[model samples]
Target: MQDLLGHLRSGQVCYSTPQGAMISGDSLELLAQLPANSVDLFVTSPPFPLLRQKAYGNEDQQRYVAWLTEFAKLAKDALKPTGSLVIDIGGAYQRGLPVRSLHQYRALLAFVDDVGYRLAEEFYWYNPSKLPSPIEWVNKRKIRAKDAVNTVWWLSKTDDPKADVGKVRVPYSKSMERLLQDPQRYYTPKDRPSQHSIGEAFGRDNGGALPSNLLSIPNSQSNDAYLRACKALGLSGHPARFPIKLPSFFIEMCTDPGDLVVDFFGGSNTTGRAAEDLRRRWLSFELDRAYAAESVVRFIGDQAPAKVLKHIEQMTNGQVLAIDDSA
Candidate 1:
């Protein structure tokens, strides 16, 4: 069959090196082709069904959920018993009415539950720049809401999923330090402090504290940190990108060196970049050929110590990482 992307736009695979891999095709179909129980981590944000219009888009809400469900099952079967699935999904808005995002979650949760995958934990990637919602004034009463965040649902197949929370943990404020001193104080802990939360806290020194779910990292579109990190790594910009710190934190928290990381959507290849920077092997898939080409360029440019494509040639074999998956 003719490649959909090929007919629309030329698609190219990049970085045959073990450190990076990219493919151009339908994400769901591509994911199906992957080996089962192969990846250690799967991180991605599938396009939301809200803005239901695209050139080559399949943005129908029910269809989107169904599509995701089919792959979710395959992902469950393909993931290592300990592998983690990190998904980011946007909520919905319609005709001045606020829509609950749980629909996506509900459909996804059903599959994960049916597969018997354990609900390990979840993270909220708060977008502080999100637009505010409208309010209705009824007989002097008022209501106001903001579109300020997206949820990062972290899932695992087993109860003891692999996570090095230290990777995601940020530092405590001076006030937190002073407050912790008084163990008996009745304070509402610092908006979910890292170590204070009931989860794995990786990267903490003897004196360092854990991080909170209310992450302060803005999306890469608005944050210079991603560009800075990419520049330091020797790559260019990817607009639909997440800060390296986000994925880097996950690498630190859930994975070790020589582990395998996969990002099916692979939008800007942020996940793969993070994996390589941390000394782990990565494989990514993107339906958009243009983005896939950019991923390769970015990977090679940043991974090579010098501006030499020859260095990428040195990478042949990829190390494999393992994860736990449940029903």
Candidate 2:
């Protein structure tokens, strides 16, 4: 169980705290520099393949699958045999058409069929609070409904990726709990309409209720430190920021304390923060220097007058905040 903190090398170091470091460079380059089989988990939200170009980095539909395929090889090379790669890719439209883009599906297939990674499991992140998008289609034309879900693909280098369901279990319903006390009285062990047998011990509490693959985690973070800092400093917010809970679920289930986690696409550095808060060693890479510099604010927990002021001081370092940031 050797720690890979010192082992990570590459890119311009924006800043480093005791928890982890964020590299200011291309993620693929950083992936190449890391030793083979060094990372325990690769959880990231890469630039989604959108129909329209986004201010934040994202690939166009025509070349998205091929584009993402290249990174799959690099990511596979860096992951340990027991490691998992959890990706959160958003849904996209077909520009003028009322159809949805299948790049997300195609990219998943490419990662598995081409890159030699196994499909660990598929999870969906349902953002209940998502605003309506694609004004022409969803809002104006009234053809499509609000796109609120993102596909979280869990791809593993090996068949047996390190995941414990017990760690990420949810609470059970009151009726379900009551039935566990006396199974025979409440329900009989018989076949149902769907021909699925209802076993007597079905209600057994294995810690808590198993979580569904359709995760209902709303992506709302108005009072969060990272967003707050970005706004006050006039640094444009990383538009596509996933909630902390999304990464938190996968990290706890797939990794242990001191396990090495990497976020190749460090936009808001949410994955790194989640890993650090959970005591997992992490490394992050972002091509944008400003975004990378702003990411440091998420790491600092020292006493400051205001959180925004703290972020500005940390970003500036009281000067131009210049360094040999090129890795």
Candidate 3:
């Protein structure tokens, strides 16, 4: 993994911890330099192709599928045979119309059919805190419901990619708990309309229940360390940042400790921080230098605010500082 870091130019690296490094550059260019078949998981939420443009950058909806497929081609070569490529892409409304764009679906097809990656599974991230969008249709007119779900496509190089649902299982629900307490008394094993026969093994305790494909996580980071540090430094954090739990969930399920995780569109470096906390080797690439430099705050644990600011200043000056994880 260190050799992967060596491939990056010193100027590209903003900072490094024992487990990961944050690089500032075009992800496509940086990704091309790394050794092929080296990444264990390439997970990220690239900028959405919306009707309007954002500060971070987004391809026009008309060209988004092709634009993203270019990256997918390179990413496929960089991923291990058993590795997964998970992308969280939000949907968009067509300009001046109530219709939704199909760019995300098109990208999925391109990644699988064109790029030769398999669709291991599809997941949807439901952000309960998301604001109602396309006010023309949803709010004033009251026609459409709030758009709160982002389609997450989990792709892999092979049919059997490395994954373990046990790693991300959720606690059993209230009804499930009652059934587990006294299975024979509270429930009966029988087949349902689905035609799958239920057996005594269904009453066995598996520690936790398997999670559904629909993930319900909120994106309400009003006062996290990353935002606080950015506030203190008078810097603007990445506008399109997803919740850390989003990437953390995938990292835990798809890769083990010491596995390599790379996030090419590393806005706010959420994936990098998640990988670091989970003890996986990581590298995040952000095109904007300021956003890359400010993301170091995510790794500055318990360090004095003054010293942390100094480190940010050094990164802004193009110096790569070694982070003290113990701090």
lDDT of each: 0.60, 0.80, 0.89
lDDT of 2 by residue, 132-191 (tens): 998888899898899999999999999899999889999888887778777667777789
Which consecutive 10 residues in model 2 have the weakest lDDT in total? 318-327
Instruction: Estimate, for each residue in 181-216, the C-alpha lDDT of model 3 and write its tens digit.
Output: 999999899998899999999999999999999999
Clashes of each: 24, 3, 0
lDDT of model 1 at position 1: 12
TM-score of 1: 0.70
User: Against the true structure, what is each candidate's TM-score?
Assistant: 0.70, 0.87, 0.96
For candidate 2, list the clashing residue pairs, or say none: 11-327, 12-325, 12-327
Which candidate has the highest TM-score of all? 3
lDDT of 1 by residue, 149-174 (tens): 77777788777878777655566677
Which wins on lDDT, candidate 1 or candidate 3? Answer: 3
Model 2 has a clash total of: 3
